[model samples]
Target chain A: METIKNLLMGFSVLLTPENMLYSFGGVLIGQIVGILPGLGSVIAIAVLLPFTYSLDPIPALVAFCGIYYGSQFGGAISSILINAPGTESAVMTTVDGYPMAKKGQAGRALGTAAISSFTGGMAGSILVVLLAGPLVQMIISFAAPEYLALMIFAMACITGMAEKSSQAKSIVAICTGLALGTIGLDVSFGAPRMTFGSLALYEGISFIILAIGVFAMAEVMRNVSNAKHNGLQRIHAMEVVGRVGISLKDWKLIIPTHIRCTLVGFFIGVLPGVGAATATPLCYSLEKKIIGEDNAEWGKGEIRGVAAPESANNSCAMGALMPLLTLGVPGSSSAAIMLTAFMILGIQPGPLLFQNHPDILWALLASFFIGNVMLLVINLPLVRYCVKLVQVPTELLFMSVWILAIVGSYAVGLRVFDVGMICILSVLGVVYGICKIPLAPMLVAILLGDMIEYYLAATIVLCRRSFVNFMSRPIVLLFLVLAVLVIVLPMLRDRFKKNKVQSAVDIIDAPE
Target chain B: MKSRQDLLFEIKVSVFLLVFALVYVILTLVGIDTSGRFLQGNAGLDPTTFPYFIGIVFTGTAFYLLVKSIYQYRLNTEKENTDAAKGIGIPVVEKKPFPFPVKASLVPYIAFIVYIATLRLFGFILDSVLLSIVILFYLNQKNRMRNIIFAIVFPVFVFLLFNKVLDVRLPIGYIFGAKY
Candidate 1:
């Protein structure tokens, strides 16, 4: 009854004209930004962070939420039309989405993606409403030790579960982030640790500057070198996108997959550090397994392939946002930026947030529900128009991106130093990309670093200067054990697989 | 054997990380004030403690990367030699050379640095407009009219959107004394 009342109150706050307009604007910008190659929710939110500085907290939250959800919708457009994913999460979609487009069922493929995304998003929001309150209540008992252990577990999970990168590279990336995080004023003692006498380094590096440099600028450098002069030709291929509505038969087919993907994605999302990048591929592979690898339709424009991932991606977004709202810990890169925005707005998200800022929390949740609906209504009809976004010339697109990145960096502090820093990071980002190092873990580490340090400091004080006392807490021990398992289990599995392969090869050689 | 590009990239990154870690360690040691270090009975209360821990971890990781990359090069070489001895036919994959831009890829980055460096003297609009045109020309974008329009419009659009509507401040030109 209280939940229903709270939801009703939330809807009342959300339906106000001003909040509604902000939500609409956020998703609108998100969709457009998502359709653009090389721009994702992270860049969108980061670039828009400075602009949100002056707005009311509710509207700011609404706009950011819109961008977050809207980008997921936009990412699928290019993946289907041009075989290029607009967001990293959309990478899985392109595998079967583009193939479906090639088969001239582009409309059906896009329709399935959009509808499944809506279903998944709704499931995620509903789960947040149902589960977050209870979860927060449970976690409220946690002390600094448990929280510190949780952060370590999250980092370990990220390093261990990163699908494509080597564990060594992931570890290096995380360590690099931790190192960068230690820059500027030490929170505990208020002493500068590594500022090197520069005032700009006093506040440490801005997350927006790092994001713009690594994602936007690094992407421009890569595209400028690898892209064809006539890369815009892919936009003409947009004509095949027929009509954007799923068939009744196809809807029936995806019903089970949608339910499974949403549950998996939402649960993974609730877990800190694991994100849509993990969820989507897991959903894809699970679907392939269910369909059986022998099935010819699995990868060759199978509607389920598009449906499963798109659903999981959006559901994951919802799941990721829950921790950021209910707890202060962010579950994904986008949520990390959102948490930064929350800090900028002078609002701390946690259990007390429900009591102290119930208005903001409820209204933000309400807007999320509305924003998903808005995205669906806005995206389906505009699929044809959104597809034309790919038609923008590379030169024009790159120039616009560069301008946005420069202007956005300047807008942050209105300082030239930020621009200089962004330029340097961009170069480093290019190098990291060339070396096959993952950038996300590093970004995650940087964002979570201060919290980790803060918790560690608090734990030390609480334990009376003995780190061993942390093990006395059951929850803390559990988190530490989980972290160890996360790091070790993958290596064990890999070694097992290697041994099995070697035995099979040996047997073949001996018999021959 | 490992590709030259792969080896060069790995070595460059390893060296860069090593240097970065080294600088971090040196700066933390020098810049941090240890006057209050012993005052806090809990070592975690000392600000330098976390930074030192991160620094050591960073240094260790960089060293591991350096050693592992070099080892991988030796292992690849041995594998190549073994394959050659067995007369195994190795597939020669065609390597795509890095597309060396006409003005070089460094041009845009350099242009951006110059723009920011000149922000106070030239202002955001003037510097941005000039940079856009220069970058487009450098990229060999052929549409002169579109380039001119975009060059003028994008900066003005960003300036107006941010400065006027968003109420964000921007740097004005010292040369023309334009206030923004």
Candidate 2:
């Protein structure tokens, strides 16, 4: 009854015209940004963050949340129409989505994607309302040691889940990010550590600059390089969207996949440090295995293939808000940026959040449902026009991204030094991109590294200078064990697989 | 099978990381301002302790990576030699250059830097317009009038959106006045 009343109150607050308009605008911009390759929600939110500073907290939160979910809807458009994933989470969509487009079922591919995204997002928002309250109460009992252990578990999971990169490389990237985080003034002691006598480095490298440099700018360099090599092949959208929408038969096939993937993605999101990137691949591989058919058309135009990953990633986006709002731990890179907004708005999201700001919290939760509906309405009808974005010349797109990145970086600090750093970081990003190094771990590390240090320091102080005392805490011990398993399980699994393959080859070679 | 180029790149990255870790370790040891004895009594909460530990761990990981890369390189080379002896050669794949002219693609990045460098002198409107025009020319967008219109219009749009609507302050161009 209490939860129902609170939810009703939240709905009343969110139904206001001003809040709805902001949500509309946010989703609109998010869709546009997500349609453009190299301009993900992380950079979009960062660019629009300053604009939210002067607005009322409720409307601002509503808009930002809209952008977060709306971008997921927009991401599917490019992935299906052009094979370019506007966000990392959308990467898996292109595998099956592009194949669907090639088969002239672009509308079906896009329609299913839209429907699945909405279902996943709605599921996530519902989970947030149900799970976040209890989770916050549970986490409030945690001490510094538990927090330290949780962070370690997060790092381990992320490193293990990294795509297309060796674990060693991922570790190197994360450690390097942590090292960079230590560059500015030491928070514990006001003395600067790695500034190297430069006053500009005193405040530390801005997260916004780093995000733009590696994610946005690096993407531009790669695209330019790709266009230079591939001669800029044009992406032509299908003239007809076959059937224009999903039929009942298609819905029956996808409903189960959506529920399963959403559950998987939501759980992963609740874990700090993991996000949609991890969840999407997990769902993709799981869906493949469960198909149980030798002739299963995965990586082809299988609707379930597109449906699974799209739903998972969208759910993952919603799931991420769980930790961010309740535990003050950002579940993904985009959420990390959102944490900055929460701080800027003088709202620290943790145990006290619900008690002190129940109205804000419930309203934010209610806005998620509104935002998801808005995204569906905007995306389903406009996908055809959105697909036309692929037809825009590659050169024009590159130039626009470059201009946005430069201005976005400048708007953060309004200093030439920030631009200089962007240039340097852009070059670095290009190098990293060329090397095929994973940047997600590094981005996560930068966001969590300081918190790790702070927690470690606090735990140490509480332990009276004896680190061994942490071993006595059961929760900490359990998490430490989980972290170790996360690291070692993949190695064991790989060795097991290799042995199995070798034995099969031996049998074939000897008997044949 | 791993290519020779991939192996070499791995080795190079490992070596670079090892050297970087070493530098980090040295700096943490010497540069941290402890204000007195590095370890006075309770070493747990010391500011330098965490960084020092990280530096050490980084060094160890980098060394491990270096050794692993070297081992993998040798294994790849040996496999290649064995394949040659068996009269089976791996197909040589040539490295492809960037599709667009490298210099052409770099033009926008260079223009962006120039715009930022000259922002104070030219102001936001002039600098943004000039930057947009330069980029449009590089991209080979043939409509000169359209380019000119966009170059002027985009900056004004941003100015009004940021300045008038959002109230976020933007550069007014030093040459236009003294207002920032």
Candidate 3:
């Protein structure tokens, strides 16, 4: 009932014309950012951050939320239409999405992605209302130990998995972040470490500067350096296989896929380290298994495959947002940037964000609910019209990316140094990408580095850093065990799969 | 044996990174005095530790990468005769070169650096417009005049939104900030 009442208040807040315009502005920019390769939510958010300095916090937040969510929605368009994944989360969607688009069900494929995104988005918003406030409360009472444990859990999921076959790259990426996090003044110990007398090092590398630079700017570098271009092949191979109209036949098929994908997306989302990027692939594979290979088109333009990943990714994107809003433990790269945003606002996220700023929280949550509905209505009939967006002339599109990057960095502090800093990090991002290093771990390491050390220091004080006391604490012990399991269990599972494959191959090769 | 170049490069980068990490860890331990003025927010638990911790992790991960990449390279040589060597992922195998937008990406990449660097000199409004025009110019975009026009106009629009409307001050770069 309280949730209902708050949402009503939230609707009233979001319904105001100014806020609605903010939401519209966010979605509009988000779509463009999402579609463009080499740019991500952080860049867009950072770019937009400066613009929001004068607005009410809620409206500013609403706009930021729009950029993040809008980017996810827009990411699908490029991933499906082109083979390139616009957002890291959209990578999996490209696997099956592009294939379906290539098979001539482009419109249907796009429609399913848009509609499924709306469904999962709505479901995530509902979950946020029920779960966020309570979760925030639970978090507020948490001692340093609990926060440390949660950070450890988040680190485990990110560093331990990252889904890539190469564990080496993932580890390297994580270590890179850990190293960077340690730079700057060691305020706890009252020392400047690693600055080497350079004043820049004392301030420490800004996460957004690094994120935008490494992820967006570096990407620009790499893309430009690469002399080859894969022109959009689907346009030439155009074939609309799925029924043109989302007829009753189409609705019957997609609705079930939509619901299933939403459940899968949300469940995956609520967990640490797993998000839409993971959920999209998981949903796609699951949908294939459920539908059976013969009837289902798995890849090759199957509507279900397209819808499942799209819906799951969108759902997962929202699902990812929930934990960050309530608990402050960001679950994805974009969420990590959002954490940076909250810090800028001087608002410590976690459970207190809900209590201290219920109006803001409620307004932001309700905006998503309405924004998502707007997405559905806008996407179904209106997205076809949004094709005009693609026609906005490439110059404007890319120029806006640069503009936003400047706007966001400057907005954070009218500091000229950060703009310089963003470029340096972008170069590093390109290097990390080249090495096949998993970025998830790096972001996690950066986010958790402070948390881990803080908790460790506190524990040392509480238990006198005594070995026995430290080892004896139940939560600490549990975290230790969980941490070991996180690393070891995944290795064992992977090794088991490898061994099984080898044995099967040997058996097949043996003379009978 | 693992090929010399890959193993050597891996070891070299790892050692450089490790040394860097050690220096950081040592400095954090030394605790240079910051006097009371610098601290603002979460500095008590040690702002240095998290990122230094990041450095340590980087060093550790680099060591891991160096060792594993070397080990895999050796294994790949022995398995070279097998079909799995070329199939799917046979770690250490080189990927086919990226085939698209080969030259076009450089346009944006260089423009980014130029735009960022010139933020103060060109002023946010002028540099933004100039950088946008230069980047689009590289893309072989046919509409140069329009592109230049938008680049100049767009930042003015951004200036209006951020500075005038939102009341957030931006670096007028050198142009607007200088005493004329």
The predicted structure with the larger DockQ, 1 or 3, is 1
CAPRI-style docking class of model 3 based on DockQ: acceptable
TM-score of each: 0.94, 0.93, 0.86
DockQ scores of all models, one per candidate: 0.55, 0.45, 0.39
RMSD of each: 2.5, 2.7, 4.7
Q: Flag the better candidate by DockQ, 2 or 3.
A: 2
Give TM-score values for chain A, per-prediction: 0.95, 0.93, 0.90
Residues A1-512 of candidate 3 have per-residue lDDT tens digits of: 98899999888877889999888888777876777666778777755665655667777788888888888787877777767777877776776778867767677777777877777788777877888777776667767666677777777777565664556566666666766676675535645656668886687777777666666555555544442253211222233344433556877888888889888888788767776767877888888888898996666667777678777877787888877887788887788877887776667777877778778888999999877876666666655555445445544555566666667666665677777777777666765565455676677667766567767677657666466876676766777688778778988898999999999999999999
lDDT by residue (tens digit), candidate 3, B1-180: 455355555556556545655665666555544454544343244444355555566567666656766677666555754646567444464644533343555556666767767777767788877776676566546677887788788888988887778787777767666531
When summed lDDT is taken over every stretch of 10 residues in candidate 2 chain A, the lowest stretch is: A235-244
What candidate 1 gets wrong by more than 4 Å, as runs, is A163-165, A225-235, A294-296, B1-12, B35-39, B89-103, B178-180
What CAPRI-style quality would you assign to candidate 1? Answer: medium
Instruction: Between candidates 1 and 3, name the one with more favorable TM-score.
Output: 1
For model 1, name the residue pairs that clash: none
Q: What's the count of clashing pairs in each model shown?
A: 0, 7, 42
**Tens-digit lDDT string for candidate 1 (A255-337):** 99999999999988877778888899999999888878787387789889999999999999899888788768876778878
Instruction: State the TM-score of the second chain for every model.
Output: 0.79, 0.79, 0.59
The best candidate by DockQ is 1
As a whole number from 0 to 100, the lDDT of residue A476 in candidate 3 is: 66
